[model samples]
Target: MSALALLDYASVFVFALTGALVASRAQLDIVGFVFIACITAVGGGTVRDVILDRPVFWVANPNFIIVASVAAFVVFFTAHLLESRYRTILWIDALALAVAVPAGVAAAVAMESVWPIILIMGVATGCFGGLMRDVVCNEVPLVLKQGELYVTCAFAGAGAAVVLLTLGQPLPLALIGCAAVTLALRVGSMAFGWRLPVYKSRPPRV
Candidate 1:
């Protein structure tokens, strides 16, 4: 398989794992696990494709769905083996974001999109899956969290991809660089508590 295809499958697997983990944490059943897994795996790509006026990716190839379901099953059976379940979820989500960003950017680039749209699609690809996962798991989406660097990391990585591509870097190389940048930023935040400044409400003057 091509590198991009491999990246997509790997991203889907990780995202599905996180979703299944969330379902397990919520004490939901097998069906819930699969449902959440599939959504988290394909939600971002589906949104990107729709916005780009392309066919939904999973509709073109059902292997993505199968991969997601398999990931959910694996996580369901192995959840107890993971001691740091929350930490695992965070790591997997970060990796998924890193890969999905380039996957989104590739689609836009293929369509001959302008740089701005390319960047937006990249961020959307990285973030929308997690957004859907959180919503379905009854948690606030991470992207909406005040002071969180989740979406910021995605934007930086997407922008980096665009810059690299503009400089005539090969797509695979650009994707690797983009994913590394994203993963580093996110992991740094998790390890060092790096965060954006939170909004401070001021009292109105009388």
Candidate 2:
């Protein structure tokens, strides 16, 4: 398989895993698990494809759906075994974000889109899936988590790739840089209590 295809598969599987975990938290049935998983797996890429005016990935090829369904089925049988499903979901989503950002970057690069478009596509591809899953599950969207480094990581990663590509670096190297920066920032935030400052309401401005 091509590198881009591999990235998409990786993103699909991991994102589906996170989605199924969320469904488990929501106490959804097996069918619900599959439904949520498929949506989460393809949501971001679907948005990206729609905006780009390309054939949707899962529509053109059903294997991605198959992969998501299998993941949901596995989670359905084993989710209760997880001591902390939320924590697992976060880490897996981090991996999904890392993979998906590069997949988006690769897609935009393939289309020869401008740098800003490439960056936005990367963030959208990494974020929209988890956002959909959380919204559907009635959980707070991680992308909107206060002080979290989610979308920031994606943007920084995509920005890094764009910079390198502008400097004439090869695509593989740029992708690697993107993944590295994204994963590193996300891991740092999750593992080390690193967070951006949030707004504190001011009461006396009036």
Candidate 3:
């Protein structure tokens, strides 16, 4: 398989893990775990593919479904041991975002999409999976939360990739470099509590 295809599978597996972890946290059943995992693994890519008029990737290659199901089953059997470390989902999902954003950009670039569409695809691919996972789990979507810097991190990395491509950098180098930038910024935020400034609404008049 190509490097990009490998990255896509890896990202799906990681994202599936996050979804299964969430299902465990919510005390859901095995079916719930698998369902959540499937949606989280492919939700973003499905949306991007639909928007881009490409065949839905998992539909096109059912091996992705098998990969996600296996990931969910693994998490289901092992999640009990990691209950206390559930926050690991954040790190895992962050890494997946780094991979998926570049994957999305590459897909758009492959189609000769405009730079803006590339950036949009990157952010959607990185974020929408987690959004669907959270929504299904009845939690607020992290990307929509104030100051989380989730979408910002994806945007920065995707923007970097676009710039490098524009400057004639090789695709592999651009993909790796952009993914690195995203992973660093995201992990740094997790480690250092990095956050964007919040808007403070003025007090209501008495």
TM-score: model 3 vs. ground truth: 0.94
Q: What is the lDDT of every predicted structure here?
A: 0.89, 0.93, 0.88
Give the root-mean-square deviation of each candidate in angstroms: 2.0, 1.6, 1.7
Q: Model 2 RMSD to the real structure?
A: 1.6
On residues 57-172, what C-alpha lDDT tens digit does candidate 1 reach at each position?
89998999999999999998999999988779888888889889888888888789999999999999999999999997898787786655799899999989899999999988
Clashing pairs in 1: none
- Rank the models by lDDT, top first: 2, 1, 3
State candidate 2's TM-score.
Answer: 0.96
Estimate candidate 3's alpha-carbon lDDT, on a 0 to 1 scale: 0.88
Minimum summed lDDT over a 10-residue window in model 3 is located at 79-88
**Per-residue lDDT over 88-127 for candidate 3, one digit per residue giving the tens place of the 0 to 100 score:** 8888889889999998888888779999999999899999
Decide which is better by TM-score, 2 or 3.
2
**TM-score against truth, every candidate:** 0.94, 0.96, 0.94
Worst 10 residues of 2 by lDDT: 197-206
